[model samples]
Target: MPTETPRPMRRQILTFAVVGVINTATYYGFYLLFLIALPYLGAHVLAFLLSMTGSFFLNARFTYRTRPTWRKFLLFPLTNAANFLITTAGVYVIVGVLHHGSRFAPLGASMAAIPVTFVVSRWIMVPKAGTA
Candidate 1:
């Protein structure tokens, strides 16, 4: 018997996971740098914005196997907005209500947002056939 092939969704999820690791590393590095000068929340926001920019290109090219376009670049933020909102709220709750350390709050918060972000990003980055 032949081994089963992974479904498109499964493949996408795996790819997204790889890209997410890279994006998270980029974001965390920036966050730590900014943390030296800004509040935790401020650092998170700035880092998120910077990472989302890199994420657009990575997701478009590597994750989705799609060409990068001006249109996709502009729309990419919509996918990230959901992630940003969920992670931001989560960070606030964990750090504020749960009394967690600010340094690790964003990482913990981001885990909850990953599934939602993957779905939204796939929808945005993978366009329908014959559609631009």
Candidate 2:
């Protein structure tokens, strides 16, 4: 007989996906709002930071079901740094190099970073048996 997948893992993945959608929307909204006032890169950075803040809470409460902590909050940016770097570079390349529209470049670039972000975020949010 074939082995079955774990329920907890499945739930976590589903929750993470849901949270990702919400985060993306939140980020895009902020990006659009900021685009009117700032350049595309500036808008992307500000929007990413704001959405990341909201993502911490949502991922903690909904995806990982972990308790929020000052430590985790502070460390959360580390998880996002990879995503930030990748997406920022991607946006730059897509817009500056390829001459894509600034408004939509971030949305296109960010998709590539999502899986890495999810994995890093899960590692950060979920506590080990002895660590929690």
Report the C-alpha lDDT of model 1 over 16-127, residue by residue, as the tens digit: 9999999999999999999999998999999999999999998888889999899889999998888999999998999889998999999988988898888778778886
How well does model 2 score by local distance difference test?
0.89
Q: Roughly what TM-score does model 1 have, to 2 decimal places?
A: 0.89
TM-scores for all candidates? 0.89, 0.92
Query: Where does model 2 exceed 4 Å of error?
Result: 1-4, 129-132
**Candidate 1 pairs with clashing backbones:** none
lDDT of 2 by residue, 1-132 (tens): 998858987898899899989999999999999999999999999999999999999999998999999999998998799899999999999999999889888888888888888777877887572253
Task: Give the residue spans of candidate 1 off by over 4 A.
Answer: 1-6, 129-132
